[model samples]
Target: MTSDGDDTTVLSTEEGWQTIQATIHDARGAMYTAGSTAILLMWAGIISIAYLAQYAISTFASDFAEQYPWFPGPLWAALTLPGVIGSMTIGHRAGRSLSTGAAMQSVGIRVFLYWMAVVTAAGLLPGAAGLWNETRAETIPYVLVGVIALGHVLFGILHRPVIAVFGLGYAVSFYVPHYIFEGIAPAVSGIAMLALLAATFVWVHRTGEW
Candidate 1:
């Protein structure tokens, strides 16, 4: 009878541990979903505004562009700076709330560093390949779009399948505008991305699948 009781106690303890582990797993998943939602929404707003501003500058502010000669580059950096800060802030807070907080923080840092490397490589490739001429300048935006889309796809494959879907959608939106409506490609792509991001945000909230 004592041996049987001991066996029962061991099973109960094991079950309790499993339950605790499941709870932690669920909490971490929730935190990740919430953080990703906020980050995606933030980027949606930033990208939309940045693209619109680029269109306005290129179309209506030629004088300013000529005066600066480096108008959009600085503008984009300025616009995205907030998103970078916000992402780090969100990740930090999310990490603090989880049992695996340190590991979560490490993952966030690694992800940020990965993106930094990707963007740096993209920026350097044209120069390294001797393709940084005036004509090639026109393709820079398209190249950036491709790079961003690729990043999204890769990130999604690694972390979230839905993000991969959004990435493909984003690429298609930009490509359609560029090919079919060259005159307003930037504006159209910006609006389309905004809509897509917004829709994804809504779906995630509604389904609670993130």
Candidate 2:
């Protein structure tokens, strides 16, 4: 039913599609598996501990600080230092082991850099907010939730649907509480994020997905 030209065009299109699909498969397969998962879990654990420690200091340290003047600063450094060192080590190892095509490697490195930027911005927001006022400080949690949701959506578009769906759920879980009660948003968001990361670690570990 088709002419020679039409058949040729169809064949070319199919070949193009096949090439794209193959690249996608290879890219996914090349992602760091156990290494990425371990890094994620370690970071999640560290963040969780830091958040809990911060909460404890804010809520209870007033009384304890008199008796233990050196506690808060030392504790925060202890919690944060290991995470920094571990993440760098794991990321270096993963980079060394990566066997993806140049294009995929470039994409992965950009994504990693973007995330690092996000983290740096998130870290600075609190200090910036302090310079403004308490109300501005309160918005940090909401901004972080939005950023996380957006990050997930970007991942979905670029990588996987599962991450996108998880991001949607994460955004919802934290945002809903803000509408209900603002007082608990930071704590709730931090806890929820850590829980989601924990669950994601388990899922990726079981599935061997990145």
Residue 90, candidate 2: how far off, in angstroms? 3.1
Best by lDDT: 1
Model 2, 27-135: lDDT tens per residue? 5645523144454456446655665565566567757755665454466458757766675666555655674456544544544554555555655665565622433
lDDT tens per residue, model 1, 1-210:
236536543446777899999998876555454455455556556766777787788789878866765566677779878877887776556555444557766655554555555555655665575555534544556676677677778877866788788879978977788788868778888889888878988998898753
Clash tally, candidates in order = 0, 0
How do the predictions measure up, each by TM-score?
Answer: 0.74, 0.61
Q: In model 2, which runs have C-alpha deviations exceeding 4 angstroms?
A: 1-21, 28-46, 64-84, 100-111, 126-139, 181-189
